[model samples]
Every structure is written in structure tokens, then in C-alpha cells.
Target: MGDEVPGVGAHARYVPGRFADQVALVTGGGSGIGAAVARQLAAEGCARVNVADQDMDNAESVAVAMGGTARHVDVADADAVDALVSGVTRDCGRLDVVVHAAGVDDPEAKAQLLSAREAGEPVDVLARLGDERWRRVMSVNLDGTFHVLRAAVRAMRPRGRGAVVTVGSSAAFDTLVGYPHYAASKAGVHALSQAVAKEAIAFGVRVNTVAPGPVDTAMAARTPAAVRAAMEAAGAIGYASAEDLADSICYLASPGAANVVGAVLLSNGGRFTV
Candidate 1:
């Protein structure tokens, strides 16, 4: 089975039927951690999976592979997010789980910092970060999370049962020197998730966050070598794979986490101590 499955490991275990008859929506399902979650949900027999992403090509590919539906949505837009949720609920008759994994980091800012360091100039990220760059990162990582979470919560509230697992960053709690924008945005995400979890759980909806440390992803691949090396060493397990994150995310979205609410599950591989 491992030899036949593209991304599956030789020892990977799947809980077939765990999500059977349930519908799921995964934002940023085109690639990386989101893609991994989408695949896992399908493997577990989710009735309908909505793969929402801005990149339609990648989204469509993953959707096709898992027999899910691909949706084109830029999560930073509230109306788009609302429509995505409504459409899924309207079509599928229910939305049992939502994994909000769409987020962005400031690679350009990291590049500038690295370049300044190489030239022996004092690197002040705040001084160098442009207003537009900072806003863009916040818009995607923080605002996008807000839009998705709000819309999902509303859709699930009426049902009286649902789960939402959002992807956060360990950087939210730690200092990612050159990425103040990224850190700030993710911090907002963590706080927002907890606040909403309190309210949403009252409606029998569960909202939680999975804060990951250094994960080997396409975004990570773009980081400057110096920055990448620091990240690689930051995690005790070197670096986690996107699939590793997916595993944690799926658990948070499953019945196993039924009693868990307003929690931030750190899947950072010992990057930090709570």
C-alpha cells in the first residue's frame, strides 16, 4: 500500500471511516500542510471535502486526487470566505469540520535582513520593513484566519456540532527576529482562536489551533540559507514534514479532541517549552 500511495510512508496508519459521512473544508488545501490534511481526511472516508485555495491549479490537483471539490477563494476576503462556507454547507448539507491552514510569511523581509547581515550592516527589521509588506502579511495570515473562522463558526453553530482546527505558528510565541509582521499576525491568530473558541463552544462547536515550529514546506524552502539553517536547528527533531503537521491537525479535528477546546496544540517537536 505504501508503494502504491504517492505521499504515504511505509508505516503510515490511517483510521478508515473515522470521518465517514462527515464533510470537511480545508483552506489552503492546495499544498503543504493543508494538502496533507485534505489527503488524510479523504483517506479516512470523509463524505465531502472542500479544498479551498487561491491557487486553483494546485487546489484542483489535490481535489481530484482525493475525490474532493476544489474551490477558488482568497481567504483574506470575508465575503469570499462566507460564500465558501455557505456553498459547502448548501451543497453538502452539513459541514462537520474545517481546517483553516491558509497563511503567509514575509520572505522578502527575510531576504533583506539576510542581505544586510552579509554586508555587515546593522539589521533592524522594523526599520527596513515596508508598510505595504507588513500589511500584506497581516492581511493574509491574520485577517484570512478571522474571515474563515467566523464563517465556519456561523455555519456550524446551527448544527450544534462541528470542529475547527486552525494552523498557527510557533513564531507567535517566539521571536522570529526578522519577521515581526509574521509573528504579530500569528499571535493575533492564536488570541483570536481562543476568544472565538470560548463563544463557539457554547454552540457545541470546537475551535483549536495547531502551532507548528520548523516544518519542511515550500515556503520554508524559499527562506534565505542563513535563516533556514537557524530554523532547522530551532527544532529538536531537526524539521517536521507537512505530513507531520497534518497528523496533529487531523486529531484536533477528530472525535478524540472532543473534550479539548480553546487549546493551542504545539506540534513544534520540542522547539519551545510551555
Candidate 2:
């Protein structure tokens, strides 16, 4: 852990060179991994952080806690995302980093699928895996990422210097059944980062991703004990903390990663080597 520094205003505090003087925008910054990222960046001396999420209360809470700005914008909405990017730049002057961490995991569907597995039934037999579920998952995880990345790159490219870090999942590489939508969306995220890196490099902007495995967040905590055990067995170190993943996000966003591009840094405790 690092010591906390003073904020730019009476409500904010600064961390140090980890992100000193830089402006960062984080989606899904209200809770889970997103909240951790926001706290870490704010601690690292980021001049301003815009914590955007569809949940205004959660976003505002995180913003107030970090002493940063909070905005309500659904990443799935292109216009909302565009306005958000513009608003941040106008208010904060410039944007240096963008971290996409918003995601959804349907527990009911997961539980139903897991039950089928327990009953020795074919996983695909479960009706929980429906078109609506798939669409909802993709809309948030895949399409939402595209919305944010497109908007951020537009702003970042002109500046000739910026960093974009998308949060992916170990499931993208490993065998995590029952949620094909989540897996597919994460796969798209990694692929998108690779593509972005190739194009952004010419403009001095770097793009990378961090895929975490079995992190000890609320989402993972909601998993059944058996499911959690299975996931832990796949990891070399059992489980990871939100801070562990947050550190990787910050690293990819910092100057130290100038030479690192299109890299998918895995902080999965050796669960999946990619």
C-alpha cells in the first residue's frame, strides 16, 4: 500500500508519481474492480478521475470518496459515451488514461447452469443460457468497451500520447462454461486491445489489457462454494485481490509501460498463462 497525498481541491487527495498530473477516466468505477482502480489511481496522484457508470449514486459515491468527478453515462449508449469523453476533457483539460472495468455476471443463470452440472446433466440443456442473456452480456462487456475505446481513442490520438487499459477475464483463455457471452465478450476485449495497440502506436498512444482470474470481489464471492473451489484449483495462487488487479491497471497506464503495447498482462495467480 502507498501513502495518501493531498487532493487538487478540498475534497480530493493525491497519491504520487504513479499517475501524478495525469487525467484518467474509468467506467464501472462505482464498485468491484472498477472502484479499486479509481482508488488506486487517485492515490497515485492522478490530477482528475472521472468515475462514470449507469448507476449515478454509486458513481457519485466513488467520486466523492476519491474527491474526483462522477458522471452518469451508460457505456452502451454511443451518444452518452461521446458526451462523457468530451465532458471530461473540457472539465479536466486532458485525458491520459482510460480503464474499462464495467461488467455483469448473471448469478441466477450461473446457478442454474451449475445445478445442471451437479445433476450430471448436459450444461447446454439449461434454458438459462438464452438469447436475451447473451445479448445483455455482450452489450455491456463487448459493445460497451467499443463505445468507450472509440471515444477515448478519438481524444487520445490527437494528443499523440495516452494509455488505454481494458479489463478482460481469464475465462477468455480458459474453459469457463455456462457463460459463453461473458467469455466471448472478454475475448473480444483482448482482441480489440491488440487491434487498437497496432493503430494507436503511430500516434504515441499505447493500448494494453489486464485479464484477472478468480479475483476476490463481490462478483466472485457470489459464486457457489463448489464453483469457487474449482476456480481456485485452476489458479496457481488460489485467489487474487482487487488491489492486485488494480496495480496491473495502473502499471499499464503509467509511463513505465511506454515500451509495452498490445500486451495482455495476466494477474491471475498463474491460473492461465497467456
Q: Which candidate wins on TM-score? A: 1
C-alpha lDDT of all candidate models, in order? 0.89, 0.84
Residue-level lDDT tens digits of model 1 in 1-274: 2222234333265676778889999999999999999888888778888999999999999998878999999998999999999999999999999999998888788888788778888767788788899889999999999999899989999979999999898998987877788989999999999999999999999999999998888988888888788788877897898889988999999998999999999999998977
Backbone clash pairs for candidate 1 read none
Q: How accurate is candidate 2 locally (lDDT)?
A: 0.84
Assess the local accuracy of residue 136 in candidate 1 as a C-alpha lDDT between 0 and 100: 91
Sum up the clashes in candidate 1. Answer: 0
The numbered model that scores best in lDDT is 1
| Total clashing pairs in model 2 | 7
Q: Give per-model TM-scores.
A: 0.95, 0.92
Which regions of candidate 1 are displaced past 4 Å?
A: 1-11
- State, as a TM-score between 0 and 1, how close model 2 is to the true structure: 0.92
